[model samples]
Target chain A: MRAFAHTPFGALSIAILRGFVRDRAALFFAVVFPLMFLVLFGALLSNQDQSEIDMITVGDVPLLEDLPADAREAFETTFEVEESDDLDAALAEVRDGDADVVVEQKGDTLVAHYTQTEQVKAAITQSTLKAYVDGANIAASGQPARFGFAAERVEDESLTTIQFFTPGLLGWAIATSAALGAAATLQGWRQTKLLRRLQLAPVSTGTVVGARVAVTIAIALGQTAIFLGLGAATLGLKLTGSWWMSIPLVVVGTLCFMAIGLLAGAIAKSTEGAVNMANFFVLPMAFLSGSFFPLDATPPWLQRVSDVLPLKHLNEGMLDVLVRGQGPSAALVPLTILAAFAVVVTLLAARLFRWDTA
Target chain B: MTAIAAKGLTKRYGDLTAVDALDLTVAAGEFVGVLGPNGAGKTTLLEMLEGLRKPDAGEVSVLGEPAWPRNRALQPRIGVQLQASAFFERLTAREQIHTFAALYRAPGSAADEWLERVGLVAKADTRVEDLSGGQAQRLSIACALVHDPELVFLDEPTAALDPQARRNLWDLLADINDSGRTVVLTTHHMDEAETLCDRVAIVDHGRLLQHDTPAALVAAHAGGGNLEDVFLALTGREYRA
Candidate 1:
């Protein structure tokens, strides 16, 4: 027990944490930078309502359309299209804001107009028009009749930007704090030959690495808590999952990122080079893992790229608990991936680390 | 009993040989100094003996156990002051020493006492980064000696100190030696090697050029002048980086 207490890992961890607190620059980069990013990303994601538009069907247009029997039956059940022949009048109604959108037909052309110049509205109108044109084409070709497009009003839950960004911010905070705290500190220790000294002591390397991982996890959790508290109090964001679920995810994510940091520190020959390596890995994870914005708009191949990032799974797990109010079981895939990442990186770091100045 | 024994020890880094094949032994309770010029492999030999580095081809035994990776039981029995051992910048000198002291199974609780012993009591609470070069060196010594090991390895311990501080450190080291602990140190200062070491090994270009008492070496090679003249005769006046 006495020997265990003096293990290099725990002592180094405590020492590193104390050093971080005393260093104003490190404290700013480790603690404050992520908070600032959270604020920025939160502000940007605040307007969810603007991304969805209301679909207001005008009137019965079935009587005007030369619909096939099967098409007419499907259209009658799905839509309440207006019968107004005055397409200009209906478009004017949309232009006047009385309706969010208006759809009409004019000599083999389907024209859809929106009241507001919203990207969501434009997308919905274009898709609906395409469906109508395709239906008309099928009917003219005397093929089996298909239903015309029917716009359904998607009543999306209006979430503030901060609420939408909270999960991503949490992931970013965990990654930044864990990676910078462990990797950068290790590099500095190596540069000064402190690690070589410690290696000569009665301490094991496992103990040293374990202690650093523990401290990094603690710091990461503190970062997560700060973001959660400020997001809730200041931005009205809420974490819907239980503490038992969220806390474990935080721990797993911290371990995964800390391992990556250790590997980076071990492989980098100098402090300057370590800094460059950390930025090289962490920046890509941040941007591509949907920390700042939704990756849903990106292509399928890009989404596949995000799947390999630990931050992506971290964010997904956080969203599951915070947004979907799911349990730990609901996050098994992400949790497993994070654990796997931690194990692999830890092994790599341990294998690559050099105690002496090479 | 022999506290340290090395046979045909050699270490090489690529094309450069850091520690050439060498045979050395230190009896228990003896104070030995390894004297050499820059790049003479004095530090490298010390590292291998201290179990911080493995010899490419050699057998090293410290307290009857192999020296590379060091037997855990033998660790508490040996203390090492590396050529550039560093402390956490934010930790007070006392904290740093106490932390190291705790590593031993039966360490003293009087960290401040060790600091005072090293002439750092006034700066016990000062962070390591705030200490002067001499003060930091003293603190490093205090850390090494805190556990009161049976054998101590000091490498370049007085390299960057003022004359007064260096003298004080020498007296402290002598006191430690008088207490019946073996001291293995490396230094380039001929006067220090002459005054403090019971036996001296002069090495150059990774090989042992001479091994005997400072008096005996001078009598043999310096025409009875001094260890410096003996050293110059063996290593020559050429500068090495």
Candidate 2:
């Protein structure tokens, strides 16, 4: 038992991580790729007031004559409506910083114009128009109508996009790094006949495999740390939970992904084949696991498909803690699924793992 | 007491029979070689004996323990050097040996001495990826012997070496054998078998064709000329693959 306890899992993992860090190219892909995605997406999603038109202005309109008083009030509440002296001036406001959209009454029809990009302006106009129309209908029917849905503003505690993505990226980094590292290591060993040499020794296959997995986990943790630090510094991703929650999530993610890597290494007949297999598993998981995008808007069937991926559970667990400020107890389902994934994949890898080249 | 013994050992891979029913035995401290052609199942036989592979229909005893899924207690007592055992590319030769040594409860401090013995002392700090092929092979042997096991298995230890390196390895093997440990090696090189092995087992298509002292086999088959002719006679001039 003591001999098994000292089987180089920890040391081997550290060495593997060091080797990965030493490789600048691998480090960039493993750590920088997902971070780049986070920063790019975060900037796109940030609510900073970069554009000039934060409000829309109206001109040449009898305010409450064409629409009911209640409808007009609903419109005013929904949009920051400004009154301008002339049509040209209102259009100018639309073009300049004052208005996001200009609603000018030409005879009876309202012409909405804005310098805001089509997508942004269109979304604002659609929501405001819907509220105004609904309010008008409610006034006609003599019923009270709400203008906009109550902004369920639960304290200012929601995690930023970066915070939500950081843990997912951490999971991705660990999985890909471990899978690639273990597969490549195993292939190279097989090519050099090092595995065959070890086979002849008193060392069990389990020991060799355990060491490789340990090394992979260590490398993965290092990759995770690098990305987490970068996300915190550059993207302001925060971890609301204690280290207990974070560390175990990282460990479970590492074990599950390392198992994937071992299976790839075991099944591949050659180094090139192993590389292809690694890509086959890593690439799809990256996209489908909601690592880069939200799965909320995706179809239900797609979400079910994603549920089978180890990254999905990892990402959900991370989001639960970092994004939702929930404890591990809330993340129990994802954690359990991830643990099962780790155990199943590891057992399969061990069974399928071959030491000989053939 | 016999250090190693095999009775009707056989192994098959799907449609191909890698090793046929064969019987062999080696007394303690005897240096034996399994010499055959490229696909003669020499490796398969060695793997079976080392507990890396299970025999299809035979029994193997190594130091009074069955070889397959080897008894844990008997593991530290046996050393094996595969023809192509791999090492961590990032780990230096010394670190690799030390890591393996740490796996055992009681290990020896012969890693540095073994490195020096194999002429790899200067390259001790070199990673396995950076070492030359011959250096890597030497390091593999050093790793196997670091714990000072009583029985050693060497499989094609000198397959792709230059003449000087090969001679050096032969000398190293001779020294290892001289330390009064039993050695069972496999090779395709008849000269290696003739020069290094006290007794040689000639196998073909996984079956034992002949087994005897080098001189006795040659005298019995080649009229006392050379082991190569005896090997050619045992295994015809046909490509394996």
Candidate 3:
């Protein structure tokens, strides 16, 4: 009976992990679901930067044909211009969503007809046409163009939207599923009196809770690796910083979420209640933390709210290493914040843990 | 030597006392039965003795160590089967027993041996959630005894079993006691107390009313009927609920 003192806790943890691994639903959440999102968001966003507006020109847009070399080249590159002798046919195509816009010249005025659903494409098409027309008008007036400019990409290599979203997606996967999984697992154990039964043994509650947390962190790491591997292989994800920097970041992120889950489980009356409470926290955090979009695009007040959130730090820290190529130093602040969160929530969970079902 | 000794064991929940200043003792190798009606504090008394619960004001020693308020060192020396045993949903019967065995650091029977002893060898690989109530009860016994502890506490172990299954379990308990290990159990069945217990303790309102052999109890209080008559005479004919 006095063999290895730590064997019981380790065994209990392994047994618990085995149960989760064998559950199909758990496996789907831990592995399959995140990969599905990676594939979807990767394919959808990777092509966004390279997309062009398909336009058909009607009437004599002499401004387009007489543009300066640079302006003409820019217009050609931004739009796939197709000359149409029949204006009615071109307008029909634009209305039916087959074409993005139709450019027409009426006397001295230029008109662009576009569909509202294709607002972004239509806006870009209108701006480019206006710039070309203004340049042509200045040239026709026999005056030097007030200013000439050419678009140039600042980065050495253009970045795909997939590269921008990969790290954030990885954070989202751990923050959403791992947190919910931990809460549900703890709540289920309590509901089924498994915790009560374990209390009968000589093992301390700390050992039991620690083992479960270790399993959660392991699963989180696995989720990160799978997402990164899938993103790199399929979505052309470029790793800027040392990938090893992501390991600690993932651990810190997992601890932060797991602690929140523990707190939720401690307060929940049942397994169902725990899941509901977890969703209440995870769903909003997934959005506000910049998991799916940039927090910079959000209002300044909302960004301030997101800055204090652990997931925001996690996503931004991950983006630093995976997207921006920032080194280990970039993750220091996030790790500290997450560690603080872990300690606080863990203490609260310990205080609230109940061995009895009641 | 006394396997269990309790002095002024009192436990209360809010305003209601579950186990009042009760005192009891059981010697080594004795088969003791604790009989009580619903809400009579039988489970509470047993739990207190097993160290699963703390007494409001009392001292309990089990297996030669203080048992109340928790004694980790004594946990491995005693086996406990709660009234409602719950296990991990995904673990099989054998796996569940192995889990407890690991926790106890058992040096005795292996998980398979315990499963065989409990007559569940054929169902060892079946998931716990798929097991019937009687099968789960039997599996709980296997888990409790897997460590081969010197003292075993069984609370309503055969409460949901059929007549044959109950008889089989009774024989198993008899065999366990015959091996010279102490066994303490609580039940509402008078026949179970008469047939299995060397001494029976009857309790009501968190107090011990009587403690004696079945034949002596019947003789003194049965009015020439049986142990059931003695129980009804003491606890009354009114339903506990």
Candidate 4:
């Protein structure tokens, strides 16, 4: 740590950090508020299940008459099971959309015919059936498996709801805090004439802004630690492949958001106005970017809009590394897009920036 | 040596001219006050001279260097005091001055001494927000002068203060002026200008009406009247400040 006893950048950064630390509202908004969202969303969505699939049994499906009663119960919860002696009737029911899938035991193999009208339901039905069979095969051989109540693929790992929300909500928190904090702080300084005082000093605008950015990045690191720590410790957030990769992703995200904030501050006429403007943009962007909801269930138009949102890319990048078990290369496109976003906004902010109030 | 020299200074926001083509000069070691009513462009003129706001058409040289485009070399050589609200968000009186001193890379020892000089030693740990109006104003002055600049600029340091508070600030300014650093202040308070300024520049409608010693300005304009009457004589109206 550079002591406050020397250097222009050090002094300015220390003062900014101290000011932020001392401000109760900022601390709550930046750190505590996000944690609350994590606990709320994490708990609410932790046990959320995929929609049940409808299935009809037409023949002696011995796999369904499983030796383990718990695995069978698990399948029942995921698929509404029905029995039919006639194949034509079962196939007609699936075709008529009464059932999503029709499973029949033909000689030695279990065959499943599913409807295409509801693609997601059909896909889940097929996968869940396969996982049950796979788990049964392993269980018969007497290998320890935790797939007692839930169908788990023997070879592949899947993302859970808690894992998904950790980064999504955390990303939302970082974006809002960095952007709002920058806008309010800058606009406040301008209103109070602190901006002019800084202009009079030997310090350059670059130094002042750079200090602010550095401090935000530091706080972002802390946010990541606390968010991830709480998520892991209490919410059962499993740290998967290259979870450390989120470090760089978060830094870039903070930069982009801070640039947006600086631009908002420069354009707004008052501190209160800047805060309103920041929230006006950040809140809707959070939902659109899939931070609060999953994008797969959204309309095509919403997905298309999210394609251009910076937070979307940030959330995608974080999901890729933190939960999807991706490597360092997974963050490349997001890094570039966010960096470009930051540069463009920084330039725009510079154009509108005034050392004194309008 | 001339501390500040400006020529053809002008600033305009759209069709409204805030500061007309104005020229002024101040010798090194003189306490000068720019006196005017509110919105008379005194702030615009001082900001342009301080290298904070760019003039639409003008040139400002401070401490023998171009102040426009911001003379980086001359930054530490001068100080600018802002309003009390400009202090860092929740800084104590001592921390505020220390931060400013550090920005200019001045000696840390000067920060504490300034708090004492401004009579804020007992309130050194008090956050600026909690300070009384006058104490906050004094702390603002201490922040500007923490680096011991050769020249200092203050923008309405005593506005909104009680009479006793205002007098305290005036006495503080007098102490700083006694140290022989060039001081330039902008104020609508006529008595403040007349009492503390060695020379007073009366401006109205963005034009300089008079710039002279307080005694000379009073003698040359109103004859038997004070500085307020001098403004009345210049504008044919009551001086609101």
Local accuracy of candidate 1 as per-residue lDDT tens digits, A1-358: 4454455555566676787788887778767887787777666655444433433433443323666686567545544444455657767766776555666545455556674455666666566557666766776799886554455554224334675578887788778768766777788888877787778778786776777777777887787778888888987786675535767889999898888887888888887777678767887898899888888789999899999999999988887777666776877888899999999998999899777667
Order of candidate numbers by TM-score, starting with the best: 3, 4, 1, 2
Q: List each candidate's DockQ score.
A: 0.36, 0.32, 0.53, 0.65
Q: Per-residue CA lDDT of candidate 2, range A242-307, in tens?
A: 434766777778778777877898899887788679878987997899887778879999999998
The lowest-lDDT stretch of 10 consecutive residues in candidate 2 chain A is: A48-57
Q: What is the per-residue lDDT of model 3 for residues B37-143, given as tens digits with 9 covering 90 to 100?
A: 89999988988888878898989998789996677888888888874456876888877888788887764257778788888988989988888888899999888
Winning candidate number (lDDT): 4
Tell me which residue pairs clash in candidate 2.
Answer: A13-A215, A193-B84, A193-B85, A194-B84, A194-B85, A194-B86, A195-B86, A197-B85, B20-B206
Q: How well is each residue in A1-358 modelled by candidate 3, as lDDT tens digits?
A: 3344227876777778778887888788768876787788877766656477898999788767777786777777788989998999999999898999888888878889898998789778878787777766776799876775767775435346787788887888898776787788888887876776677778887788788878888888888878888778877777885677889989878888887887788899988898789778877898999888878788999999998788899888888877787787988888898889878877888799776665
For candidate 4 chain A, the 10 contiguous residues with the lowest summed lDDT are A147-156
Cα-based lDDT at residue B50, candidate 2: 80
Best-to-worst order by lDDT is 4, 3, 1, 2
Question: Model 1, range B1-241, lDDT digits (tens) per residue?
Answer: 9999999999999999998899999999999999988988988888889888889998899988998766777888888887434787688887788777765533546566788899888898898888898898999988888888899999889999999999999999999999999999998889999999999998998898888998889889998689999999999999788
Candidate 1 docking class: acceptable
Question: Which pairs, if any, clash in model 1?
Answer: A9-A208, A45-A161, A46-A161, A59-A81, A59-A82, A60-A81, A60-A82, A61-A81
Chain B alone vs. reference chain B, TM-score for every model: 0.96, 0.94, 0.96, 0.95
Whichever of 1 and 2 has more DockQ, that candidate is 1
Off by over 4 Å in 4: A1-5, A48-156, B238-241
**Better-scoring candidate (TM-score), 1 or 4:** 4
> Local error of candidate 2 at B223, Å?
3.9
